[model samples]
Target: MIDLAKVDYQVILLPPSGGKINITDLIDAWTHEEMEDQISAKVTLSLKNVKREDGWMHQHVFLDKRLVLEATDGNGWREIFRGSVKAWKTDSENHTVHVVAYDPNYNITISKEHYYFKGGKTAAASIKEIASEQGIPIGVIDGPNKPLTKKLYKNSIANTMMERLKESERKGSGKYIIRSTKGKLSCLKEGNNSVIYELDDWTTESSSDERSIEKLITKVKIYGNSKGDARPKVEAVKTGKTEFGTTQEILYKSDFDNMKAANEAAAEILKEDGKPEINRPLIHPDIPWIRKGDKVRVNSGTINTMCIVKSVSRDMHSKKMMLQLKE
Candidate 1:
């Protein structure tokens, strides 16, 4: 078994000048968070009156330099984050420099343009194309192939793309994920993590609360455009109650021209309700490659089910991993 206390972290810096600097010796404390969308890290180092080679402040050269964090045992190393330095600051009295970095995707800005995607491809392909256009690297894709209809990106492609992806997730299609270590994006159809955390050993602890009502929807009404009528009316409704309850969601997608597609959309929207309670657990497991979208089955006294990993935060110095779990 790998020893958690033996795990180590190293920061590799590549400035514009093209040489690498190992900042492990200067770091005092570090923290990094890996999310489904992005990865970020912050390092605090003690550098006294450090100057740059170009006769400028040391912090200036690191403003946009490439930063990479890795975890290593005696055998080899594994990259955890890959991004450019975004901002930095120095403490006047402590002589400590605080540096923050984000994944390469954060640096990409979509150019405003009129864009439309003609159907006939998978959503993963569309997402990959969008990321390529924006200069973001493609990591892993685990999504289903659904005929993408007319998708429009008017002012900001990033905002529109993210919204559409989230909408797809709400429909229980797949998950769109962004990793920082390689600055890559991926779409996952289901949990890909093979690591299992058995809660029976008391190593995995869970804190969850179930809600009384979870956005229950008993009615679905779909409407399509009319030929001659000015305003469109309801075309069809689910064979159930028509009255609104305390918790109800109404889905109206005019783009769906057929009742079959519209009904499917309504069912997808309603699936978001009545899900298992999400929880965050601090797991001290001796494992590697614990990341978002990893699948693990929990067998404990209270809970025994499979869940997908949502977020992972690690402190290399402390040797602890806080994981966010979702059903």
Candidate 2:
């Protein structure tokens, strides 16, 4: 259990020269980080009311510096974010500084290139190759060994790689996700072990929203092209008629070669986009481990369901967690 009254936060600053400075006592920082599919994880650390000291200014803590934020409860300290500082701001009146950092992968910008992945490459292997080419440190990729057919990649290299991996997620064959946890990139498969967060009457605040949609998709037309077949189109339909009307969605692809692949693509798109969406925010707690892409089982009155974490915002000074849940 986290003692909200005495929660402790540790913030470290690593200068480009390489020594580390524990600035937890010197600065009040708020960190907000999010994990999203394909894109690099983002971290923003706002150091509020930091006392102005000699040899420390906005220009001195240039874009090359790194920031690490940690938190501790009854358990030992855990590092939440480790990122390179991208921008900083100074408030002269309050003698404070604000620093923003992002995962190292953010620096890996894709250049124009013709890239192709052979038919036997797994998504994890392909993602690893891309990260290694850009010199990004990676962690474990926990997913199936599902091999993909030959796929030609163009446009932003990173974006193309993400699209390929996301196909697996869309198909529901695997919940393979690429995420950065404290600067280490990994492609994680869905797991049964999830963090269960029980909401109480005294635990911060909670809100929920449920709305009906007028437009719902029940069918998907997937267009594809293969090596032998020039143009292949497959349609997947789910039997359902909404009160608003029947709607059809079209998905365009230039990659599938056969009817099986095209049909899989159509089914995945329909299954993914054909349902009503939900907006459920994360149940905020002082725990530091609740990050984006992690699943949490929440038990509140009339609402006891599992949700994937979308984003997390924390005030290191007050030790409060702002949760954003995704369905």
Candidate 3:
């Protein structure tokens, strides 16, 4: 389990073209609440100088629908994320977000949004797309390769049929049957009337007579026009299997549960009251100079080190600050 108190989210703003600026200078103004099973956080992000003609590009944050941060770019900035009200809130910390500025001629300016995280980092995809596609609550998985077993819809029946055939081969059945409303489908061994079976309605089956169908159904060919970046030949085997009376195989690819896990982990790490160790450079450098009312910290390199700085030489030659050392 991740500590939601440690993760941080923020938006970064970049100057218009030809403007000099530092990304690190922007401060994180938002704060997070205590860890709750359900909560929604909304942040309105508006930026200037984005190309109007270009379509919307989204950034995915690992959180619930209610916890999503909405951002708008280009003319008349629009809301990009909004749906369900049930979601988790974002944690507070200094975060950096990437902003791109584009001119009429397609010229681009890139900037960053700085933020903080606790246990680990969040997923790269935006939370909106994930929620819409996966049809699951946000922050479910927080690691890579996490398998999400989604129920099959009516449209997925064909794929499921193919998987059943593939599974039959793996189980040494070497035969299967698919019965659909249209007709009977089957694949059986030679001279094996004893193993014959009735086909079910609304299903597809494999048969020895139509063994060539397997090669055709499962084969994937890559095609391209020019050879420079043309497609390359690649082979993929079916993985998913189903067992009726006989067995069948299907070409099924696992879902991206890892990304969801990463998002959940990130959200967990962002919770409040979770103080995560972070690497930050000292605001002031250490130098020996005698000055009154100078603040300084001890030589402890830990996060809780005591440090201070006072008035310094304002002259051009000595562009340095005076500091006092304290134990």
Candidate 4:
């Protein structure tokens, strides 16, 4: 078994000048966290003033320079994060500098452009093309191949990518997740994490069950435009009386031209949002490699079920982490 207390983190700096530097000794603190809904994993580091080849360390650290964090337990090293430095603040008086970075997808989030995707292709195919064009390295890509019929056009690359990902599930395909680490992009089926961990010991503490009622949907109205229709009209309506009464959702899509198509869309939403209860546990010991979308099976006492990690927050210094799980 790996000793958790023996874990040590190292910060490596890759300057634009084309060389690697070990700047771990200059770090004061650092944190790494990511969310399932977000498009990027975030990293923040605080550095102390130190002498370097180019002058004081702050002078050499500039935007877009690569920053990497890695950890080891005397066995080789595993990367925690690797991305370009997006922003920094040099505090001369305090002799310190603060830096923030995101997984290579940062550019995609800010870039806007028009893209044309032909029909008969899956959203996963389009997403792969985008990632490739943007130079994001590809990893495991198992996103569903359900073909897309909806038109996609001008929008922020991030927004457009997110829309396409959502389209997979919106059109009867299963849920999918897109994530990046060390500049490598991965798209896979939700809850299908390749690495599985078993949680059976008392190292975990249970947290309150969360009822995500805000996402609950019992009624749906899909509006679609027809060939002769001057304006879009309700193509179909789906309803199921819940305890909270009518919680409505309105969707306007150009492809929902008939009631049959519209009703299927409505049913899909209801099936996903019908269950509001989403539970999470507070895991004590840190599991550095356990990231969002990773699967874990809990077999401690009364709890025995497989779950997918929903989110993770980790302190680079201590290797401490907290996890949120979705069953």
Best by TM-score: 4
- Ranking 2 against 3 by lDDT, winner: 2
Give per-model TM-scores.
Answer: 0.80, 0.83, 0.14, 0.88
At residue 324, give the lDDT of candidate 4: 79
Best-to-worst TM-score order: 4, 2, 1, 3
Q: Relative to the unseen true structure, what is the C-alpha lDDT of residue 307 in candidate 2, on a scale of 0 to 100?
A: 68
Pick out the ten consecutive residues of candidate 4 with the lowest summed lDDT: 201-210
lDDT for model 2 comes to 0.64
User: Candidate 1, overall lDDT?
Assistant: 0.61
Name the candidate, 3 or 4, with the larger TM-score value. Answer: 4
- In the order shown, the candidates' Cα RMSDs to the true structure are 4.0, 3.6, 29.1, 2.8
lDDT of 2 at 59: 39
lDDT of candidate 4 over 148-258, digit per residue (tens): 765757998888888887766877887777788667888877677666877665656444445577778899988776567476777678886588767888777665444
Weakest ten-residue segment in model 3 by summed lDDT: 102-111
What's the CA error at residue 186 for candidate 1, in Å?
2.9
> In candidate 4, how many Å is residue 290 off?
1.1
What clash pairs does model 2 have?
A: 281-325, 282-325
The local lDDT score (0 to 100) that residue 285 gets in candidate 1 is 44
